[model samples]
Target: MEFRCKKAGDECYGVKELTLLSEISQRLIQTKELKNDLSVILELLVRHLDAERSFLTIFNRQNSKIYIEAAYGYSSAQQARGKYDLGEGIIGRVIELARPIVVDKISESNLFLNRTQQELKSKDGKDLTFVCVPIIEESQVTGALGLLRLYNPYITKDENLYLLSVIGSLISRVVSSKQEQMEELEALRQKNQELQSKLDDGQRPVNIVGNSGKMRDVYSLVNMVAETNSTVLIRGESGIGKELIADAIHYSSKRARNNFVKVNCSALPDSLIESELFGHEKGAFTGADSRRKGRFELADGGTIFLDEIGDIPLSTQVKILRILQQREFERLGGTETIKVDVRIVAATNRNLEEAIEKGEFREDLFYRINVFPLYIPSLRERRDDIPLLVDHFIEKFNKRNGTSVKRITTSALNMLMIYSWPGNIRELENCIERACILTTDDVIHSYNLPPSLQTADSSNTQARGGLMYTVEQVEKQLIREALTSTKGNIAKAAELLSVTERMLGTRVKKYEIEAWRFKV
Candidate 1:
């Protein structure tokens, strides 16, 4: 009899195994749509196992919540979402032990073992055999599968315990396959992220963000420059994240572990700019009391960032030209020529070529740093990234402030997409951070946006006076109202309007509105 019972268990497990395999094949063929299919699968499992009622109770580890995703032989109105302590009910016991439970009779078993009289109270006229099974996947008991028969016995006429375990094993495979698919999809997602990371591996931090065509070119250029010690010049508007791109390049390359030194040529005093970059000996000048290494010396065998390079005075430009050309420099009050090996990455918001033409910047110096040039399109160019960037920022600021800002209302998002972003990502980041700090609800609605963005409706009403305008008129008025509401700053406008700068820029271009040309 024991041998027959063991064989019966194997047969049941075998049938369940086949069912689960079929489910997996079906699931794999359908791609990422997994939830709906789960319900149908569980319902059939209950019927095949000859149980009167069944529940697929999944434990949400993230929230410590239990959700019944699927049920069989039960009405939807019955409230299948029965709460269970992590170790409370019979179902909880299966989960607590990470194993399955088979009870010949529930009235006599010690298994309905929750602390509550709520669970101890049996449903009226619902005496039945019970089977509680924990669904284990990747060594974690994610949920439990259980069944109760109201008027009859759970064991088939075959009296097969093997059949019961077989069905349990089948359900286990289904759960395992679903998790495996999710993991596989995640692996693919991470691989794509690595590919995206291949960009930003060089000189002056790139000024561009997003994976649009133009931005991808910028990333590729950064990678190519990072592989060798080259003079890279970055051209972009103010607040375009130029420093970020520069950091990406230096940190992603072969010299990633080395130092990355940065200096703002325009931020330093004109008198001290040259010495700050090339270093000065003790007693070289008034404050030269101790020997100090310049940016180049600190960046030796690595990369140095020169920001706002266009602002360097002609006197300092000559010294910079010497460093680029000679790869050697002499500190103030010193006769020794110090040789240095450093990759230079420079950024500017000015037209260096025009500067050279005007004889303000040396022609040779312009060409020297221009060996690998990466020009980032302004906020107006890749407006498509506005929405994506908005979501990115929301996720970012939510963590920063430790709040769960789950969503932004569609109207609010639409507003942001219509406005131009002149200040680019910096402005957008500030807007989101502010919203995070101030929003009182889980979702940020349109009314929650800043006052600048709120003025668009009023401006639109004032301009159109409730007229049904043409598409062109509506588009123009909308963009105009958004910009006027947010002022001329594109990133601000984009945020106020809840649109991407790229989208807003497209409208500006489509309508040929000439006031918002992007300038670095």
Candidate 2:
């Protein structure tokens, strides 16, 4: 029963040796579980080498210790007991020294710990040879492999060491790859947990569902100005949650318990805006049968949210500015001047600067209300929040409609993520609500979404010489137009786009666009 080659001067592997190695290598590559693959590999090596037993010990970088990952014949309890610190025993020393050790007699070696209680002697009472090789990856020892065999004259110690070292190298790659995959999975899990925490925090006040960087900046601004009495001007496109931000500011402020009077400047007519803001005395107007407290007076010792401030007429702006300056204003046709202590939080989707240039808005009034301007990002600017917003809206509609809708399909979510949400968060909430009403199942499929979203990209393509274009392309085109209008002036272009110069610069770089090309 000879395992060695009989040919003279033969140093290479024999036919049987080559066949066994090939089989083992293929099995290892095909195996999925690290522990199972290691166990099979150890078993194959012990049987082929005629070793009594074999085991693999893996290193834990975090704790600087080695624990048995797999053993050829040891029980689970025995394997669990095979943990060791560096240089603690024979196995540990092999890893610490980063080399191979071949002990002719285990009893004679002081380093033999026998921690797993394995039988170390042969049937004939002959001393067992202990062999250990370091598992190295990228020039560093990561683990060790141990083998025990009855001393035999048929195989040389050098031959056994060489074979074991080759196996160690193969195992090293597997261990390294497994560790890398595990680390990546752990990182992904941690990131998900962090995002979930941010979403939870966003649900606390005004239910501002977003975890994107832009939304984080908005949240920081809200926190900074919430405790102050300074007037805040919330600005963004329509449906961009400007009013929600105004509510967050008021409720989070020191006057949270006080009245939060709301006034829709656009809803009131030019003849009544002044009366709506400043209370009119009885018989002052056709509809004023009794003396009425205006939004300002009603919001005294609290806060007033002036929505769509840009819609108010210039005549009304003058009165609003007077109250902001002197904290006192006479109601329409009222002789006595009324004063109120109120914090003002105004919001508007219109571009006030453009309005002022067109003589539609008063610059003095704008300056008075723009003490602390908080710009809310539109949905397109923070697309990462779309999924969180969808989940929130779905849950909201589910509770409202008394349904059990759980989630949106993958394709449906993809469409939501890609679409340019021109109408912003409000539009998204409405879309989700509509889907909830239409969907009979728990999941909102792609077909459940509105026709506008389904054909949004195709519609853009039809407008662009029948060439398909992504949301990014539409954005780039808009940016290019703004740049051309501004003659490549980043500051002016950014102002036109309602974004900071730095943000516009980042977009230009991302799109690989040359703004200088648009210069006259």
Candidate 3:
């Protein structure tokens, strides 16, 4: 527990001591590589104090063990030998007691347990003086700093011990800071695993549609990550409903009651994107007449959906990256710092890795947002869910349009099933809505669908007889639509169809169509 230092009357000793302390403090503060910087600090200390060797030991409270973290003047084997339980050796005792320990001569002191098996004497054959000091933080010992030097008769026995204690205080700060970071990372890892396990016990997202194995996996991921504050990156092709997945995640989370703000990174012009995101004070820009809160601020205590995240400009990406890392930002024209407890749910259809290669995206930001990636499969990849989706959209549009369209005819449904939906679910929904409007009865027929859908390559029906029948069906449907659009005016209907009135009438008669029935 000794901590007293006798005043040295020699001016040279005082100057040397000040010089060592200044160098150690500067290096510890300036360098990001703390462990390597610490070794350098140890080397400085040993050279300044005229010591033979120096070492730092850290206590792992979880395991009740102490091991060397950094060292100077010790071989790899010697450093590897330095490990101890809480009260087993001198380093252990220094940490366990939260005190300094000094051995006048290693050979004569029974307490001097040389675990490293180094020679007891110096190169000059003088017994080495061993000194150990506890590295403490907030009144708790976390580690120890120790060094070996030949005994100096001119200096007091506890003189070097006091200097070691001061050095220990500096080491404690760096060691403790690193320990805190490690502890935080480990805690997050455990919490993530726990959340995954809880969701695996079978909670599904109620909002997202589809039961294909891929969609089910998406549902599981949404449920799993809903309870966590981790940032989520939803990757998929456009129209694959990434936004819907983002919606399910937000509404199912603890922040459901808070504002769930959404920002389309691609929709905003580059000139105004930063202002839209971080808000602006009045007079910040030419059009800024009043102060406005940004999407991040509005989503405080909730989640922000940054759709088309990859399309954000590189300049705005830096600010976004800062917000993701620090959860704080300053408004575009305001000096006041704003902090938000918002979870970010970013989505993009673009390949971010490719964007990174093209220098169009920030690599660090990519890693940050990609922590929990959820890839939504395209409609083609999960065609098994098409029937369910068709039914869902049918029921939805049915209620909206006050129509009793109960189902699609097999031929129409076959065409729908066969077409390559490059635009995914959104295209399917639009097709269903268009068909619902065209149908005059409960059943939607193939002729009522869009002409592009009836193409032989798309509908997979290319036989000569079948093609002729489909063409005729399409012609009849088109003439009926023209009549309806023209309100039974033959001339206007013919003009709309780009056909001569005589030919239109021939077709209408051939199909036995009642043109006047289309008049509302």
The best candidate by lDDT is: 3
Q: In every candidate, how many clashes are there?
A: 31, 0, 0
| lDDT-based ranking | 3, 2, 1
lDDT per residue for candidate 1 within 1-520, as digits (tens), equals: 4333332243564565467557645654665555566666656656554445666776655334344656665566443335454665677677778867667666667766421122222366455666767777667877777666432443452333344445445566565555455556656765665554453333224443475456667777777777777788889999888888888878867877888999988889988887888888998899788987777888888889999999999988887888899888887678889888778899999988889889889888898889888898876566555666777888888777789988776577665654455566786777677777778887878777766555645333222223333334546646755665554555456666787555666677776653332211
Better of 1 and 2 by TM-score: 2
lDDT of 1 at 32: 52
**Per-residue lDDT of 117-229 in model 2, one digit per residue for the tens?**
76768766878888889989999877888888777656678877887888787778887765565456656765675666566476446556776667777887898899899
Q: Candidate 2: worst 10 consecutive residues by lDDT?
A: 458-467
Clashing pairs in 3: none
Off by over 4 Å in 2: 1-206, 457-520
Reference-based TM-score, model 2: 0.57
Where model 1 places Cα greater than 4 Å from the true spot, the runs are 1-209, 454-520
Residues 167-198 of candidate 3 have per-residue lDDT tens digits of 88877878787656555665676567566545
Top model number, TM-score: 2
Ten-residue stretch with the least lDDT total in model 1: 113-122
Please report how far candidate 2 places residue 335 from its true position, in Å: 1.5
